[model samples]
Target: MKRRIQINIAGRVQGVGFRPTVYRHATAAGLAGFVTNTPAGVLVEAEGEDAALAAFSALLKAQPPVQARVETFAVSDVPLRGDTAFVIAPSQGSGDLLIGIPPDLAMCSDCARDIRDTANRRHGYAFTNCTCCGPRYTIVRALPYDRAQTSMAAFTLCPACQQEYTSPADRRFDAQPNACAACGPALRLLDKQNMPVPDVADPLAAAVDLLRQGRVLALKSLGGYHLCCDATDAAAIRRLRERKHRPTKPFAVMFPSLEQIRAHCEVSPEEEAALADPSAPIVILRRRADSALPAEISPDTHDLGAFLPYTPLHLLLLDRTGPLIMTSGNQSEEPLAVDESELTQLLGTFADFALVHNRPIVRRCDDSVLKLSGGRRILIRRARGFVPGAIPLPMRGPPVLALGGDLKNVFALTRQQQAILSPHIGNLAEFASYSFLKTAVADLARLLQIKPEIVAHDLHPDYASTQFAKEFPAHTHIAVQHHHAHIVAGMVEHNLRGPVLGIALDGMGYGTDGTLWGGEVLLADLCTFHRVAHFKAARLPGGDEATRHPVRTAWSQLVAEFGDEAEAVAAEFLPALTEIERGTLRTMIQQGVRSPWTTSAGRLFDAVAALLGFQGEVTFEGEAAIHLQMLAATAPLPPYPFELVRQRDPWVISFGPTLRAIVQDLRAGTPPAAIAGRFHRTVAAALVETCAALRMRYARHEVVLTGGVMQNDFLLDLLHTGLQARGFKVHSHALVPPNDGGIALGQAAVALAKFFT
Candidate 1:
């Protein structure tokens, strides 16, 4: 029988103790072998009795380490050579670098146990991690994931720890971040002036006590710093809000455990699984009606963004502080602070104390945000435990870079059958966010060793990302239409090819025709898309000004429907509107002066929310729409009337009937909640009917629902359920965000298709 075999394993093998596991299994099978990490992937050579080798191979495939994900394992025969023992050879950097980089993982159970055990050497160690888990993407400076190439290079292992590193039986075998408290990074408490605090018996306890005192603390984490305070303290929460300049934006909380989370909010099985998973992200859970959480925590919202501790430091702090407001460690619209100097400089004025750590965070990845859709997790903002992890492409193409849209910006770099999207970089309207965008792109390219031949960007020239794309020298820059990218992203995410109906719904996008587009129906594939239908055009008085003040948009809609009679009705609905502002808005809409026409579904929600007297001026991007969706009742209601008129090539879906019905309901003294519920159902029914009509003409049943408006779980649930009931194959985003955060993936995928197909 054959006695020798060589195997090549790819995908998430380098940083996950894969080679050590392979060596142990081979030795147990009495096989003389050696395994090593290569630039491409992991390589192993085994020589032993045929049966023993067979068992070894089976073990490698079936019983790999918990963190090791073997996507491709290939075996080939090799000539037998007598060898003494199995060994994990030193990693080789030579080869074409095509390996998948592992994202930062949560601390494993073993590490957590060691950190908690009183007798263990690593007891109370905040950065305790084994080979199976810990920072990877955040600590990594280059490929071949060795300690020498990471931020941990500065911390050498102690003698006793070195024994664990060399022992195959030990959990810390070949652990890149392996170290004891004597040699590894240490925590220190610093005042606002960046000087270490005096006479601190325990820094962690001191930090917790500070938090208990309702003081804002800037605490260092694996990826970056976080501004933290007691979540239940209303005064402290209000102070943080004022300091961060984040008036109405909801803050994410870090609870100690699943039991504690269940105590506050309604957590479904799906949400529980997500919270308990290795990549512990912030899961937005629906708060219980009787929840005792302070109103200031979520302020006018039904859902709370909650996450379990992903690190030992967080665990320790949470053990002392029941729950903490753990938000990004930066001012509003700026990139998250990573370095100590940067954190101190940016947060010193606000944070009462800085809980600093010496463990350098190479990359600044913010906490990821997600929620459930149809019993499955949907990412809102992909970061921290999920960044730099490549999404498999349908096919390989020339390397390309795609700069996403203005809001919720995320860029992507494409390579052979994979697209690695950047973490959420906020809006590019701010200089700091724009700067982060540039650094993220360059850092991704450098780390992955990608030289992009083609660049992709949005069609809008005014977008900062679009402008950034143009600055890339010697690259072919392709401008993808904003809505087209939104639709195609859903297609690429689901690995769909050929034609599918795409319902692109969001706030606004730069249309190919130059008018603002949001609500759109398109026939899309990887290469291109064709707009088939859209919402009827309505003037956005004062353009972007109409977005912040929903009353102006409501006035625009009312003027579109009732003309002069709209003023009297508008006065009744929007009591906050000043007559002078109302008159000016009316004149702007009538004269069409700087009033850009838009077919935006988001605007419709804004108008409806304004009509229902929910919000006059939005404090956040989707504040009014989010409030409207939350106010909607679970009981199903009959949809309001809407018209699908085929007056032009692409039929216009008019909201005139819906607006008129809403006006009547408001005059009839209907509850705003009832109107909101009916409005949501109406939008869903209208979209479903439009899809049915499109199906009759195109005969395509698969519809991909995408865009920022799809973030509304109420509308998404209704639309997804209604569309599926009509015998249609529906696809919505789960891996990437439905918002512009996912636009880069679509852009990159399209560019690859155009070049290769």
Candidate 2:
């Protein structure tokens, strides 16, 4: 056995106090070594017996930073180069390879208790951080995490603080965000007119008073500024809605704790973990049987999105009672406030009371959304406390950046085999969202320090991001078809670098052929994609008017597929629509009056929900799809009535079989629950068969499912389990949402492929 051992620890080692912890552990074990921060990670050149080295290695990994993730360690035999003492060296760059950056974490329980304790020296400290926990991604600047390269640089260490920072045995050792009342970012409460409030002894008390009085307050947070109010009070929620000009979109809630959440809504073990994660993202939970939250929260739904505290400030704010309505601090459709000028310009009149802070937000990151399904935490929106760090693409490619689609926009930068997706901005149509996107794109590019050879964007000419991509005159701008990007993303995630069939389904995307496309099967390659099959063209009778009001889709489906008699017979589908709307829809379908053609699965979901008398008005995007998936959870195993037929030499799935089944169910007056469940199961079964047939010819080729439709658990589980059982490898998203939320990853991936091509 080797007498001496050496090891290189990598992944998220910098910006986190990795080396100090290493020294503490090594010295405690009585081993002579030196730990130095490398560009890649930390290198511990230790002189010890093999047995002792083995034990030290275990101890190193077992007690890593709660915020920092240790991806790997390379341990090997070393010649005796015995050092007198274990020490932490200064920071070093990790060559060309991108370094891992840890996400911001919630304040540790110890630090939290100290902050709440009035007698403690660090009482009410907002930036109280130890090596084990507190701001990582949020406060960091450059990596190889040192005091000088973070926001904490402004605060010189007091003598006591210096001692604690130097002592490895102490928790604050090398904690970059470490500070006390003597030194740190200060807070100032402001009135609506941009003037600081005069000597308010208790800002929290004032904030609570505003909340209780049904007044809106804009509070700056770890991620960004948020507009908060009492969610339980109807009048307050109504006032917030009017002030923000967001009539119906559901707002996220922050409760005191898990027990408080359980009191309001029913949460599964999976959902509880997601809510309690360091990210503290908005998690969708089922409403309890005795649900009584304000209707304004989930105006047209049965579930509520909830989150726990992720910051010391959040904990202090939640110390009192009522559920707080914490929504992004921006006007309707705009990105959350990040910049000082923007905050003053947009929110000056929107909030009655404004809680401001001096710390600058280098970049804006929205709170990530998550759902726990099948006992695994699935990221729906990879933002806020979880972004910018590169995730290795399963396949290798060159560096490039892709500006994502128009809605729920996120951008991505790819280098080597890793793709770093930028945080969620917002809908790009709004000027604030567009500006945030612009800043974030530049930020990631600067952070990675990569000059891109190519820029990728959606095929749509109207998307603001696409327009921005064209402005890069020197860079090669590749306009990828919207659906093709979706296809390539799925394939790239699975490392399926070769040509394969792709099924891209969603609400709408600009097709390569210049018509709206959604439900499509395409023959896709890295260079190009061909439309091989698609859902039968259906008339969107009211054009864009049909989206917010889905009953039009239901009416059109009836008239186009089952004739006028079916339209008259289907009263349940027409509930949301008035008599005039019903008459107008009938006329539009019969005459093909101003109808836009679409094959969107999202629209189909809306139609299905309308037919079953589920949700009438959609407060948010995918509202219908989300509720439909919930209904589908009650569905059982049954054969779907769908036929794979060759239409004009291309294989297409005929919804005719499924539509007929639904019509028959309507005639028999089948319960909406049974009908909705059967529809979900049927679609899943059809997809499995489609992939299975294709795989038979290719002899073991895999299937990768993507798009917003794949966000449906009922459909996803069906395809995953059913396809796997039939001996085919199935790939779906866990890190990113399958929806347009992850469009940037696909865009970046495709852009990288073009560089190699």
Candidate 2 C-alpha lDDT tens digits along 1-757: 4356778787767656677778878887778878876767778877766677778889987987655568788888777775667667655555644554667766667787888899988887766778767776666676545677667787798888888888876778877777786877767778877788898887777777878888888888877788898888899899888877777667899987889899988888778867766667899777786867789986756668899877777787787746799988877667777667767854566788887777676666788887766554456788876776666665575567788898888888878777888888788888878987887777767766767777889999988989999996535888888877887777766667656767677889988666678888776776686676677778898777888777788778877777646646466456666668778877886787978788888888888887777546676787777776666536474754888876463467767678778867876887767888888877777777777776654454566667778777667777778877888676777777777878777777777666667
CA RMSD per model (angstroms) = 2.6, 3.0
Q: Which ten residues in a row have the lowest lDDT in candidate 1?
A: 93-102
Candidate 1 versus the native: TM-score? 0.94
Lowest summed lDDT window (length 10), candidate 2:
91-100
lDDT of 1 by residue, 1-757 (tens): 6578999998777667787788778878888879988867899999988899889999899988777667899999988887778888877766545353578888777777888789998898888888888888889889777799999998888998889888976778978888778888889999888889999989999998899999999989878889999998999999999988888889998998889899999999889988877678999998988888888888879799999888888887898899999988886767888986687675566798998888889988988999996775678899877787778888888889999999999999988788889988988998989999988888989988899999999999899998899998635889998888988888887889959999999999999899999999998888888888999889999998889988888888988898778879878888878788888888888898999999999998999888887655687789989988888886888999999987677888888999999899889998889999998998888889999999999999999999999999888999889999999999999889999999999998888778775
Error of 2 at 608 (Å): 1.4
> Clash number for every model?
0, 3
Q: lDDT of each structure? A: 0.87, 0.75
Query: How many clashing residue pairs, candidate 2?
Result: 3
